[model samples]
Target: MSSQKEKTSPFMAKAIEAALSAKSITSPNPWVGALLEHQGQIINVSSTKKYGAAHAEAQTLQGKHLPEGTLYTTLEPCVAFEGKRTEPCTQIIIKSGIKKVVIGIEDPDPRVKGRGIIQLREAGIEVQIGDGADEITRLLRPYIKHRQTGLPYVIAKFAASIDGKIATKTGASQWITGEKARDTAHHQRAWVDGILIGSGTAISDDPSLTARPKNLSPEQFTQPLRIVLDGSGKLPVNSKILQPTGTIIATSPKSEKNWQDSLTEQGAQIIICEPSQNGSGINLEQLLQVLGSRSILSLWVEGGSQILGSFFSQNLIDELWAFIAPIIIGGDGLSAISTTGTSTLAEVPHLREIVIEKLEQDFLIRGFTGNWAP
Candidate 1:
C-alpha cells in the first residue's frame, strides 16, 4: 500500500527520504529542508543541513526563480524558531504568495504543536496536512519531543538468548551479540539523550552503563546521565557507574539516610520519590516523567533481566531495543523480559513488531511497546 502511494507521489517519497537523512543534522533546529515544485518538477531544494546554516525556506528561496503559484512544499514548514539565526517560517510561507500549503505532518514540539497549521490557515493558504505523510513527519518526533518535553525519546535496551537468558548460569554474559550488534547498540545511545539502569545491576554487575557509539574517542563519549532505580537505595558506594558521568540515584524514603547521604557526598544527585507497591524504590514511572523535566530526552534501560522485568511489570517501558545473541544459554537464568505475575502477551502491553537488523552474530530487533490495541 505504501509502495503504491509512494509510486504515485514521488515528491512525498523524495521529501521523506530527505527528512530521514536530516535526522543526523545537529543543533537546536530539527533538520528540515524545502523543495519547491512547479509542474511536478523540483526546481529548487534547500535544507537546514548544518547548524546555524540556511533553513529549508531560505535554501529553497535563494536567488532561484520561482513559478508564481506552484505548490509550496511537502514538509510542514517550521513556523517558530527560538534560535538566533532565523525568523518564523509562517511569515515566509505568507510572503511566498503560496496559495496552497501541503504539510506532511504537524510539528510535535509543544511550543509549535499546531501553530504552523493555524498560521497557514489564517493566511487563507489551502492547507493539506495528511496525504500519506505520517511516517515521514514522525521523523521529527525526537527533536520536537526534545524541544517541548525537554527529554529525548526513551528506548529501553535488552538482550537474551533463545532460552530467554541474558546470561549463563554464572551470569557471565558477555558478547551476547557480536561486534556489529554491540556497535549498533552504542549508536542507539548516541541518538538518545541518556541511558538508564537499575541500582541492583549497578551494584551487582558494576557495569559502566555508558552506551557509547562505535569508535568514539574517550573524551567524545560524554556519557549521559547514569540513572539507578534503587528503591531501597542500596547501590554500592564505589560502583563504577558513578565515577564518570552525572549519576542520579532514584531512591525511596525508606532508603537509609546514611546510604543516600553517602551517595550525595560521592557527587551523586539523590531524588527521593515514592516507591511502587513492589517496593523497587523511587516510582519508576514518575522517574521517567522527571527525566523528561530534566531534558533527558530518551532513557535507555540497560540492565539485568530482572530490572527490565520490573519495568515491564510497572508498565513503564515504551519501546524495546533487543540484541538477540546468536549463542544459546540453556541454563536457568533471567529472561530478557520478566513480567511481574504469571502473564502472557495477553495480560500485558500490546507490542508491535517493527524491524530487525542483522548485525555481527546477533539480530537487533526493535519494536514499539504498547498494550494490544486491537
Candidate 2:
C-alpha cells in the first residue's frame, strides 16, 4: 500500500482534473474534488457541481453506503455554511467513518480557515495538509484573493496574430484564431462570474457576450453577467447585452439622467462611477470595487486594445490568458495594447510562472503578472 504522502502527487493531479470537469457551473464556491480509498483500492471520485449542490466530499459519499477508509480532497472539507441549502461537509465526512483526510490546500474562506481540519482532528481522525501545495494554491488564487480583498479576480484574455497585432488598421479582427482557440475562449466565459469589455468592443463588435457554444445546449448553458464600461452612456439601445438579466452599464458620474433612465427601462443596471485619473475613462479600481460588492468572484476581460491598455496602465490585472495565431499581421495592424506607458526596455511588464500550450493552430499562454513592463 502506498503511504499517504506518496499518493499525494497522483491524487492531486486527479483531483485537479476533477475540479476542471465542473468548471462551467462552480461559481461563488471554489471548485473542489475528493477521492475515497478503502484498503488499497479506490472507492469513489467526485467534484463539486453547481453552487448549492452536493459539495465534493458529500458527492463522494453519495451512494457509497457510508464506506470509507481515507479521503483526499483538493480543498479542506467545509466545516459549515450560513445557508440551509447544504449541510456541513465536515460532519458528513465524520459520520462516514473516514479514518483519514489528506488535504491539498486549506480553505480560504475566513469562516472555515483551518476549522475543518481542526474539527476532524478533534474527532480523532488523522489529518494531513500541504499535499500538492503549490499547484493547489495556484488553482485557488482567485478564491483566495476574493475572500481577502473583496475584489473580483481579474483575468485578461487576448488573442493576437503572431506579430502581436490584435486587428488590422481598420480594426477588423474576426477569426484571428482557429476554431479550437475560439472554443477555449467560450469556455473561459462559462467559468467566470462576468465578462467585461469597453464600449469600443461592445459597439464595434455588437457581441452577445453569452456563453453560447455550438456543441452545448441552451438549457445547460450558463451566461456570465454582461458588463459594458460605457463612459458616455453611448451603448446602443438595441445592443444584445441589454437582453441579459445581469447586464450592467457603467458610466461616469457626469452621464445624462435620460440615458440612465432609458437603459434602466431596458433591463440594465445603471452604475455611476468616478472617472479615471486620466479623465478619459471609468476608474478601473472603482469599477472592480463595485463588482466585488455584488459578490462577483472572477471577472474575465475580452478586449479591443483600449480596455486592456487601461487595466494594464493601472496595474489591475491579476492573470493573463492570450491566444497567438500562427500568422503575422504586421505593424499596420492594431497592437494588442496601446500607450501602456512603457518607454524603455527596463519598464516592460513581465509575467511570472508562465505556462504555454499549443491548441490546434494557436498557442495559449497563461501567466501571472510580476510587475508593470518597463
Clashing pairs in 2: 346-374, 347-373, 347-374, 348-373, 348-374, 349-373
lDDT digits (tens) for residues 266-294 of candidate 2: 88998889999889879889999999988
lDDT of each: 0.67, 0.82
Q: Write down the RMSD of all candidates, one decimal each.
A: 4.5, 3.6
Task: State how far residue 335 of model 1 sits from its true place (Å).
Answer: 1.9
Q: Write the per-residue lDDT of candidate 1 for residues 180-211, one digit (tens) a residue.
A: 77778776665555677776567767887776
In model 1, which runs have C-alpha deviations exceeding 4 angstroms? 1-8, 22-33, 38-75, 78-86, 96-100, 109-111, 124-126, 137-153, 215-223, 257-267, 341-350, 372-374
Best by TM-score: 2
Q: Weakest 10 consecutive residues, lDDT, candidate 1?
A: 1-10
Q: Which regions of candidate 2 fall more than 4 Å away from where they truly are?
A: 1-7, 63-68, 214-221, 371-374
